[model samples]
Target: MSSRNLPDDKKLIDLQRFQLLVNAITDYAIYMLDTDGRVVSWNAGAQKFKGYTSEEIIGQHFSQFLTPEDQKAGIPALALQTAETEGRYETEGWRVRKDGSYFWANVIIDAIRENGRLLGFAKITRDITDRRKAEEALRLSEQQFRLLVQGVTDYAIYMLDKEGNVSNWNAGAQRIKGYRQEEVVGTHFSRFYTDEDQQDGVPQRALLTARTEGRFEQEGWRVRNDGSKFRAHVVIDPIYNAINEFVGYAKVTRDITEKYKAAIALKQTEQALQQAQKMETIGKLTGGIAHDFNNLLQIISGNLQLLSAEIAGNQRAEKRVTNALAGVRRGAKLASYLLSFGRRQALDPKVVNIGRFVLEMEDMLQRSLGETIEVETILADDLWNTFVDVAQVENALLNLAVNARDAMDSVGKLTIEISNAVLDENYARAHVEVNAGEYVMLAVSDVGSGMPSEVVAQAFEPFFSTKPEGKGTGLGLSMVYGFVKQSGGHANIYSEPGYGTTVKLYFPRSTELENCVVIQTVENIVGGTETILVAEDDEQVRHTAIEMLTALGYKVLHADDAQSALAIIEAGVKIDLLFTDVVMPGPLRSPELARKARELLPDLAVLFTSGYTQNAIVHGGRLDAGVELLGKPYSREALARKIRSVITNSIQR
Candidate 1:
């Protein structure tokens, strides 16, 4: 606009004042870019944001304000193109200043069009670095809080809807409330309060108090799902949204019944027995947590494997991702350890030769322990066969070796011994949990620091660790104990303050001979052009399986449970194979679904998979006779091979 074309002097002065007002603004960068994205005009606000004077910045390309990465990616050109074609463009990203420092910024570019002709672009920028950092920290804090709530086992932590109905329940909630998720969710939370409390409308009062004052806490008797009564320490806190409106309530309760009993015992005795009594509290909770944790790890591993194939360049990034994937596998191992601790894991108790198992693990033990630590194995001749889950035993063995290594510190001797023993009636009487039987004993001894009698007594308790926090989850020995007990055996730890520690696990001797090892010929994992039905309760797993199957030239029909799978099968579609999970929510289990499917199509192929065997298609810790099973965390290759193999078996039959 030319000043000579103005109407009058006063109006021109008013226009000058308006221009001065625009230049006076320092909080927001206001500028104009030519048709080609070169700076055509600048204000004082631009100098405040970019630290560049108008004389120095005019005619320079506006891409100079963007970071090198954005410049290299042609972001400035895209912004201009978008603004010119679509009227405006807005986004948030890192912006560089004249001093070369970067600041997180919010930017907007609008096309200055007249008579449908290209004129210039009006641009604005604002610094939001502090706000961005605050948001990131808040996100991380919320994540940590969520994980902690999910991991709580000592208390029932849950959320209630506005009207006091249970909205969400954690493992601890089910453990303490004695109600499965299906029963408690959507039900009024007052069911747990005593009749007197319910009559007094205690639940409503608590929610009201929390909503008004931000929190409410009390100690009273709460009824279990079985109608039993127990004293509970309860706290209710109002949950609020970002706008400060009340959304719900976070309820946490701890059962102090067993703690009251521990009050009569000595301090150390109470501390040790505290968790042991609480074992009943985690009955179904731990198992479900372990299974879900394993499934999560499987998903992570599967995704990482898939990602590895896609990233061809950048060795540094690939190596970092690979290392992270390895850490995830270690986490998976930990989850496996937890599953054994819960005794919910499916077992394949094959008759294993004790001597052979020990000898096979010797090399691994030696490698795991440094050269300073001496590794010795005592293999008894004619060692009895034991019916045990081989994978669990391997996990237990590795755990024991790691513990021994940690105890040994600089240098020590570790001995692994295998022997056959018979527990008489008298011995079984002393150990009430054990039964008199012929047994195969596996003992690990360490010649290093050992626990005192007090510590030894609580060695098998979960989270009972002498190590510093973050160094241990204290589940290793507990896992060994749970596995041994679940396998119809016993675990005993002998330790002294001065001498050392010897941990022994006794498995009932098996009359059956050692299992025969089968070696199958390797073939390419290629899928057929046949239709297959996939039944899985997890949405992500089900979708991933479908995608992989469809990619492999197979037509996939999927459902979230066994009942839906049955419906698909009874629909009369030609299904070449039934791929299903062992665990589902409905009354129809995988075994029943497969049975019905087989009845419908006698030669129909079936393949089952799970993170842990849920005993649906398994009997006595092993897959049912003539059944084909694939363990979870399966890769595309494993899934392909298993499906092809099952289908081939059906054809041969």
Candidate 2:
């Protein structure tokens, strides 16, 4: 058996078996190229992976598989030269397959030299597309999970550096830690513990336990920025970077004082059982109806916008489209009112100098009240910043002005006065359920027919509008009332039937300075020529998107489903961005499709559009972090801006 490694015939048989084994492997495309990098030898595996038969690829250059960008950059030539000179070359990149779609390929090339003379090179490539997609999916999932944890308002969530310095803060963290992100990051996290705990090295012990045991949990008292102490349930989890290197700790602290008291108080009986049942039923009904109605509206409204943009030069058609849009807007407002009355969300409150905000709106108010109305602005000296939802505040002002106009028969004297006000305990007692605090007062008054005492008392009640029948939806003042109360502020209406009406909205003062506000002027619509993939199941909606994007100078590829979209991606059409519907058919959802597409083309951008988010990318009525969402019924400018923004970000990437 060891006689010079067997006879020559036996050796030839062994080599043939080896060749068959190599050619039969389907998972990897194994083959050989000539000295000039031309495909000279091919196998079944190569035929399956490269979408080419031996006859088709035998004389083709191996560089054909490289992406356009790679080929343009001379990567293929360098790969061959490197393999021939350096003995071997190995790397990963996008490789074109038979149908022209791309796949993430792990490739290797070895120089083949016989008798000290260069012959050719042996090349091997494996499709790692699924592997790459899985990794990307995991990354996006982790990011969204982090966003969900950070967006928690009931817990103080933050991070500390390895040395126990605070490095991040969430909204809840700021509310609990009594510090802004600028004040907390880079500071010692030990400040969250009580003085006694710090003295006893609790912070150090916590970090050590988290690092060693994986996590630390305890109940303790923590101090706030106002030098106040509050009981909290705290947990610290050790964070590690890739390769398991120690990074820092994720800290989550929950305020349990009010929660504990509420649990105890409500343990025995449900006082609002009937009321709660009614509201729950209403919410469910409203949600179901809204989803269906909004879906139809999305198709109609979207097409209308496209049509309007297309018929911009036709006078009658343009006028009709404008009227149609107004109707759609009214319907949309009604839908908003229904949702607000059912499952309303919290106000995104910010500290704003109301004085400046009012001044900016003066021109708009003048346009609203017409020339007959005298508008006056009495701004207070040394204006204080108050925390409130700026948009809702503006809406409230506009509502009051309109009501004042209606009361005055479209002509009256309107005054907007801003000043500082204080609410003492006495005032709190007079206004039940109101807390005493220093507030920024925003008062709107009009010398018109005023409301009676009874009418004023019920002004803030839902469905209690005093406007003539067919004039209002009755949600204006009600919305204002809810906004003020939810913001930890107060709204008071004072009126004399014969005199006039004055509404005072008090927003709690804040220590933070006012943030600068930007006023955007109308600008010409921006367009792009980027290639966009539009994946939508609805034909009308898909058509509208294609038309709108095409009108904006973008080249669009349309797909009716996620599978078809992926097919297009796999076939390797050059795509700049993926504009997909968040909710789609089949197992390959939009988010998952995005992951797969990104695997094929890492620089490909993604934008999600939906009529209703339906938990696809929106969490708690807010878009997830790092996600760009364009809600249904968007205009041309909105679409252009979002697409352009995404493409710009991608270019930088």
Candidate 3:
């Protein structure tokens, strides 16, 4: 027979084999339903899957296998209608089994036809409950990740297109980058960088890095919408499709401005604290050296005075003695300067008109500066008077003049101007340790090559100078700084390269117009015959003190430390006064020793001394309330005066 006119034997054999294969499978419910929804045929798969024999299940209604809800909702009939119209209907839902229990099933109904006439439907169903649960879990995980990203406010999480334009924005992006979605979306991300960075093509470079290397990270200054600057940490990551095609980028940014500021402030505070500690250490060292050196000077001056007296009436020897006295005066001046720098020298603040003081120093400055340097003065006629140590001011000016001359190579213009001004609260707030009040401003401007900014910043640091080695001590500006601060004043320097420098010293205005009251020297005082006790650790200082007190008409008792002083006072040998150094090597303190002596003998007078005593025990060379004090290295005259003062004061008590 012709193949087109009759069925081939090969096709007949394939149909039988397909039927046999369908009957052999039992796990899948394979069956058929007629156009009226009746079970017309059932294979072994149907018999095994539904737990029914072909003889009992055939010719039964297909609706019996559907859930009650599916039946009540007409889902099975609707599915059959759809399959009849569209040729197939597929879905997954609850389907009934032989045990009357439901299983999640994937079902498909495919309409069958021959010669364009409806015949039946082929149905296939599968158990897929685990797969449905896995899909649900995956959906929940994606939701959680979205929430996590949205809650982050410190980081700017967003997306950018391949062209580097913002394609997405989150709350974090709006908060950190200071841009609303409407403002930033579709705009290039380069707008977030500073103008300088943008000009330098940093944004394009970042994009290139991300596209070429898959990621880019950087930290630097960024500008906000309001034109403020912040330190930002940024990351850009290139995104790609599943096919490995370049898609876009995801960008994240964070603001680290507050953290940066905190680090800088911590560094500044640490430096300030270190400077304060150094100053305290130097103060103690200065006081010790001054006390020891003063003693040596006293011996020299004293022996010389005696020698001059013993060799009286020799004109040549007298002239030599006069010159020696002048040298001794200069040595004393040097000691005073050291004491001033140490903040130990006594200051006699006097009120003087600022204008007149500048005028008075004009001639001295002109002579000291030489004819090569032009000296000019500007003094306000109605300037206010200021309270300060006149001699120290003169020295400070001289030091500044010498500095200016050196900076100019000995030829420059030195201008000294005095004026009255008021420092308001705003100004005081920016300055360290200064208050809002009236001030007398003394400005010293020099036309010479100026220092660099870095050098100017540290100009007041102790032992820091720019002059050639060995030519400068580096203590001039530091001394000026310390003295001005101790005198309730402020000092600052301003310099610009090639534009010269100006140093402005501000002294608090004085309410008092009277000249300084001179303090009486020990020579003008008298000694007393008080039984006094002295306590000192240094043997030389202790013996020198005892000898001076004895020579000044006082009965003296000596001790090496505070503990021995207490023992002597306890013995009750008519001790009229207790003299002890502040710092001792024993269990007893100077103050404690004084307290004990007063407790035993209520009439006992106390005088404390020390070369390295902290300021806690004394203020501005004045003793604490209800106490008497004599500083170390005292001479016979100083001892006499201190003894008389303490005794008279004790009598008054």
Candidate 4:
């Protein structure tokens, strides 16, 4: 079966069959070249790829198929020489067709030898233009995708291995996580998690969830390379290969610390607004009730005064009347406290330096707190002035001191500090009812029993107290809250279970210079003979007023409402003073009635009275300018003094 023993014709047939097989291939060009680099044989594939017939291509130089640049560089000659010397040569480059077009080709040259005699070379050329183009497009697409991921700066995009180790890091990852690519790659992804999260196995859970569910997303606290923490919104998507084989994870993290803080502030502001609205509703209801109750107390008090005068000679009867009057006075005090909590009490605000004002009340505060309590005052230099009622301020301070005394069991220190302050926009955003501006700050701190958070939250609510039953009215803090709000101020209380308490009151700064304080001397309670017109809506209150004025030796005329009083004035009644209730059930208001009565009589005096002003004669919680007002539930002596004072001032004017 060896080729040497076979017949020459059989060998010739076998060689012809081999040539036929090589020539039948259409993908690779098969051809042979002489030692001089000229083509000697060509196949059908050579003809098809080179755009020439075998007869036309035979005997042509193989360099004709090479590009001009390759020809000029002698690459074809070098290839032939290398193949003859080294037995083979292979390369890939652009080749020219017979029609002058170009195609990417894989060329291989093999040395053909005949037993010590040099022969031609065998060359194979494959047109791989499609495969080359596909490979190049794939490389370019990968490069572009890498560039896109690297250019982003807001989100930390990175890759993690299946075991949750950092595999690759982009520029965005470096920027957001504060780590360079070299610093993070090959490190555990858990390093980016906070210590608490890591201890809770959050990082491991995230990877497991993503691998099983395809994706995992969450928002939480994350740590940076520098150990600083931020609120991060994170997403992890399990990566897969073309065949759907699980590979790793693609992680994206966004720093949302500022956004998170803003959301929290918005929620707190909403809660504060709700609290303010609730307090406002309660205040309205309390004010209305106090108004009506004060009217009833005034009727009882006025009638008791008339009976006291009639039974003056009977000691026992006089003593009982005195006790009844004291009871009425207590009721009136209770109503006054309710009015304060409702912000309906009339205020006489004046521009004064709060530091000096606090100093003036130091002695009174000391006396009220007794010897067991230690009082201290810290006044800042150049303290700002505030417009407020001096009497109310004194009352507020006294109330705080007394509460502090009771809290400490009368054995603690009370500190009152006054200073100028400025509330910025940040503070205003956190406190919905507060405005950003200059303020006069008055802080009262006590080294006594401290309140918890729950107590502090309810401290401003009426009837919410921590003291034992009957030990407190529970309106002290509520009254302070309403007064501060009515004066366009803010109050804040800070306390802990065992750390004592501090209450800060911020009043709007006053730009006006301080005014001189007016001191009024007490006048004797003497009745006047001046004719007075009493206008009251309540029948019992009107009758009580008439009886009191009659005993005071005044000629009193009575009217049930403002319209009736106006009619009497229009009828030319000789009236020296018009004592009118502020709120009336008539079309004619007390202010309008007083205006018309003055028009009819130039020297007539007008004195307004009310249990609650109801904003009729009160504006900004203060009485109107040049208007005289007497609060309700007054004693017989107070009515006499106010009436005499109003008439005497009118006659002088």
Q: How does each model score on lDDT?
A: 0.84, 0.81, 0.78, 0.88
Please, what are the lDDT tens digits per residue for candidate 2 over residues 1-653? 86357899988888799899998899989999999999988888788878999999999999899999999999988999999889999998899998999999999999998778999999999999999899889999989977986788888888898998988888888877678889888989888778999999998999999999999999878889888988889899999888999999998899887766555446422533543464456556655566556556667777888788679899999999888887877776666555544434224455799999899999999998899988899998998898766876887889888878877888879999999999998787555556898998889898888999899977876678888899998877766765566566788999998799999999889989876643332356788788999999878778878888898899999999998999999998999999998777787888789889999999998988765555566444435555766756576777877787778777766
Ranking by TM-score: 4, 3, 1, 2
RMSD of 1: 36.0
TM-score of 2: 0.49
Give the per-residue lDDT of model 3 (tens digit) for 1-653.
64455568877887789888888887677788999888877787777656678788888888888888889999988999999999999998877878897677788999999879989999887767677778778888878877877788989899899899998888898887788889999999999888899999999999999998978999899988888888988999999888998889999899988887667667766765786677667777777676666545555554455457658999899888778766665566555555556666545456877678768888888899899999989887778888786877888889888888888889989988889878998676455356789999988988899989899988987668898897876778887777787677888899987889999999999877746444334456476687889887767666667766666677899999988888887786888888777777877778888888889999888877654454536576434556555544444456677777766677777
Q: Could you give the C-alpha RMSD of every candidate to the true structure, in order shown?
A: 36.0, 36.8, 7.4, 4.0
Q: Which tens-of-lDDT digit does each residue in 33-78 have in candidate 4?
A: 9999888888888888789887788888989888899999999889
Q: Candidate 1 at 381: error in angstroms?
A: 2.3
Candidate 2 total steric clashes:
3
List runs of model 2 lying over 4 Å from the truth.
Answer: 1-286, 308-315, 341-351, 386-389, 420-439, 461-463, 482-490, 508-510, 517-522, 535-539, 558-629, 645-653
Query: Residue 593: error of model 2 in Å?
Result: 7.6
Best by lDDT: 4
The superposed Cα distance between candidate 3 and the true structure at residue 147, in angstroms, equals 1.6
Clashing pairs in 1: none
Candidate 3: segments with Cα more than 4 A from true spot: 1-13, 23-31, 36-111, 125-127, 204-218, 235-249, 300-398, 408-445, 484-492, 503-617, 620-653
Error of 3 at 528 (Å): 17
Model 1 regions more than 4 Å off: 1-280, 290-295, 517-531, 550-555, 571-576, 612-615, 618-631, 635-653
Would you estimate the TM-scores of all the predictions? 0.53, 0.49, 0.67, 0.85
Clash pairs of candidate 3? none
